[model samples]
Target: MIVIEGLRKAYGSTPVVDGVSLRIPASGITSIIGPNGAGKSTLLSIMARLMEADGGTVIVDELDVTRTKTDLLARRLSILRQENHISSRLTVRDLVGFGRYPHSKGRLTPEDAGHIDRAIDYLHLGDLADRFLDELSGGQRQRAHIAMVLCQDTDYVLLDEPLNNLDMRHARGMMQLLRRAADELGKTIVLVMHDINFASWYSDGIVAMKAGRVVHHGAPDAIIRPEVLSAIYDMPIAVQDVAGKRIALYYE
Candidate 1:
């Protein structure tokens, strides 16, 4: 399990993640959902050790994220951030191959190649594997990046807004892929998402943040109620029992 204690972040005097204490289960999918500037990305980055926290501690499994060695943590956890900018000219295959670096140390073995090929197939990048990152469309590029994260084969996977830039079909596909990774591989997958419906459908647990604080965390049904939705997003939200699941409707 990932345990967080007194996690806090601030910009000047404004606290973005104010005293967040959370325990993300060791298995299954957990999605962090919130509005813009709610610090969802900031919280996720801190958990993944991509960014530093102002105060508090994040412990993944038994390893303290702040103190663990980078390579050791990389072996156990892998993160794909929301905004990925690359200045280098590299093909999809080349980029995904980099995911194996922690294990192979820049010298890929046959096993590493096998894992890379499997990840490419999972994301349906066979057709575009040879194409440079600059050549693919935004959604396709996003999938390539996802494939890299999965190729790392870490037990804990954190994706900051994996659905961004994806079309409806691809977005659903991405969620299902993560679902399979969690259930079948026994991986713990945590994601930051803006689309509430997607998070409600695929996540085992939902963490709601607002104004730098975790206002609530619970199962999908518990967190999807009208009151919870309305309070979290600061909008009128109505939930309906649709096909046995609580579906939130916020649009007027």
Candidate 2:
């Protein structure tokens, strides 16, 4: 489990994450949803130790994120940030192979090779395995990055906007794959998502943020209501049940 308390970050004086506290349990999909500038990405960055927080602490299980050894933390927790740009031209296979660096230390054993292969196959990247990242489509490149993260095989996975470049078909596939990773592999997955209906349908818990604060956190059924959606987003959002799943509609 991940426990956060009084987590705060500011750009000079403008507070982006204001005293936000959240607890993400183990072995489930937790989706953080909010509007632009709500600090959703900032919060994820802090938890993943990609950025330093101005105040407070993030504890994943027994390890304090700020104090843990870098390699140790990387072995336990893996993160996929929103902006993934590789300056060097590399093939999909080479990128995914990097994920085993923690264990292989630049040497790939049979086990490390196995992990890389599984991740590529899991993301359905076999046909494009030898293709250079620059040669692939945005969605395909995104999958390659995700496959790299999965190849790390960490117990905890944190992704910021995993669906960014994915098409409708690939977006749904990514969510289902993550859900399977959580349920079957017992990996705790936390993602920052922009689509509320997807969060409502796939997430075990939803964290709603606004103005740099967590305004609501609960199960799908509890957080996917019309009143709750309106309050969190500051727009009229209608929700209805379809096939026992709550779907949100905010289209004009």
Candidate 3:
């Protein structure tokens, strides 16, 4: 379990994440959904130790993020940011192999090679394994990045807007891939997402945030309600049950 206590981050006089305390359970998909500037990305960054928090503590399992060694933390938790830029030309396999740096330290062993292959297969990048990153499509590149994160073989994974620029089909595929990673690999996947409908459909738990604070957190049925989403987005959102899933109609 990930325990966040009074987490705070600010820029100058304005706060990005304000005393946000949340407990994210293990072995499932939990999505953070909110309007722009709600601090969703900031909170994820702080949780992964990619950014420093002004105050408060984040404990992943028994290890305090602030005190743990960088290598140790990398072994337990992995994060993929929204923007990934690779100046050097890298193949899909080459990119995925980077995840094993904590263990291999640039000298890959046979065991590390096994992890890279497994991650490539899991993300269905076997065919693209030898393909350069720039040669692949946007969705394929995103999958490669996610494959790298999974190759780290961490217990907890944090992703910021994994569905940034994908088409509808690719977006659904990405969510399904993440769902499988959680169920089959026993990974605790936490992601910052923008689409409420996608979050409602795929997430085991939905955390709603507004103005730098979490306003609500619960199951899809609880958080996908008209009142709940309407308040979160500051717009009227109608909820409907379709094929045993809650679908939010926010388009007017």
Candidate 4:
């Protein structure tokens, strides 16, 4: 489980994440959904140790995120940020191979190669494995980046706005792939999502945030109601049961 206590962050007196405490259960998909500037990405960054928090503690499966060794933590957790910029011209395979750095430290063994291959295949990037990242379309590059993170083979994966640049079909495919990773691989996936309907359809739990604080956290059926979503988004959001899933219809 990921345990957070009194988490706080600020920028020049403007609090982005305020004394927020949450418990994210293990071995399932938990999505953080909120409006822009609601600190969803900031909180994910702090959890991955990409950004430092002003105060509070985050424990990932008993390992203190603040105190754990970098290498050890990397082995247990991996995160894909919203924006990824790489100056080096790297092939899709080369990028995915980087994920094994924590274990291989630049000297990849056969096992590392196997992992890279599996990740490439998993993301359906096998055909483009030899292609340069800059040559691919935005959605393809996004898949390559995700494949790298998955190749890291960590128990916990944190993704921020993973659906960016993806078309509707690819977006649905991405969610299904994540679901497979969670159910079959037992990977714990945490993501910051803007699409509440997608979150409702795929997530085991939904954490609703408003103005830097979590407003509600519960199963899809519990958090996807009209009252909860309307309060979180500060607008009228109608929830409908479609094929046994609670889908929020906000476009009226």
lDDT of each: 0.92, 0.95, 0.93, 0.94
> Per-residue lDDT tens digits of candidate 3, residues 202-245?
99999999989999999999999999888999999999999999
Stretches of candidate 4 exceeding 4 Å from the true structure: none
lDDT, residue 91, candidate 1: 98
Ranking by lDDT: 2, 4, 3, 1
List the candidate 2 regions with Cα displacement exceeding 4 Å. none
TM-score of 1: 0.98
List of clashing residue pairs for candidate 2: none
Clashes of each: 1, 0, 0, 0
- Candidate 1 lDDT (Cα, 0 to 1): 0.92
Over 98-176, each residue of candidate 1 has an lDDT whose tens digit, in order, gives: 9999898999999999999999999999999999999999999999999999999999999999999999999999999
What is the per-residue lDDT of model 2 for residues 1-252, given as tens digits with 9 covering 90 to 100? 999999999999999999999999999999999899999999999998999999999999899999999899999999999888889999999999999998788899999999999999999999999999999999999999999999999999999999999999999999999999999999999999999888988999999999899999999999999999898889999999999999999997
Where is the poorest 10-residue window by lDDT in model 4? Answer: 225-234
Q: How displaced is residue 207 in candidate 1, in Å?
A: 0.4
The ten-residue window of minimal lDDT in model 2 covers 97-106
- Clash number for candidate 3: 0
- Candidate 1 off by > 4 Å: none
Cα RMSD (Å) per model? 0.8, 0.7, 1.2, 0.7
